[model samples]
Target: MTKQEFLRRYKDENLTIGAEYMMILDKISDAPLVLGCAYDQGVWKIYKTGERDGHYIIKEYASENEAFDFFYELVLSKHNRRNN
Candidate 1:
């Protein structure tokens, strides 16, 4: 999915958008969870952000669609776990 499409679809979810990244925040602390993505150096990167350790790269893809697909699933999984 495109960034706009992902945002629209998860408009009700806990998300924060930045110039080069999108983050899914933790409901309790309003801090960013591990789930997020950023674009740099012609590559789309999926990453996990920590409260203390900083961000870590999970994967990289050549296209936004692939990166977003992985990101969307991560968000859905987190949401599902929270609901259940």
Candidate 2:
């Protein structure tokens, strides 16, 4: 999914994108998790920042669509777990 699509789908979830539009964050948790993308040399790198082991990248993706899909599923899982 594109960033705009993700935003539209989760408009009520209060998600935030970084100033450079390189990352999206979920701030509902105390330790906000993030899905970020960066251009490293000639490659587009998509990664997730997690607190599980001292705020590091827990996963990486080669494409924005894949990254966004995982991010979307992650948010849904977190919401479901919290609500249950």
For each candidate, what is the lDDT? 0.66, 0.52
Per residue, candidate 2 scores C-alpha lDDT tens digits across 15-76 of: 43433223434321223345554434443344555555323444566766775677677656
Per-candidate TM equals 0.72, 0.54
lDDT of 1 by residue, 1-84 (tens): 877777777776764343333364221122344466767678888777656566777788898888788878877876676556
- Pairs in steric clash, model 1: none
State candidate 2's TM-score.
Answer: 0.54
Worst 10 residues of 2 by lDDT: 21-30
- Indicate the residue-level lDDT of 52 in model 2: 51
Error of 1 at 68 (Å): 0.6
Cα displacement (angstroms), candidate 2, residue 77, comes to 0.2
Off by over 4 Å in 2: 12-54
| Cα RMSD, each candidate | 7.0, 7.1
Where in model 1 is the C-alpha error above 4 Å?
Answer: 12-34
Cα error, residue 58 of model 1, in Å, equals 1.0
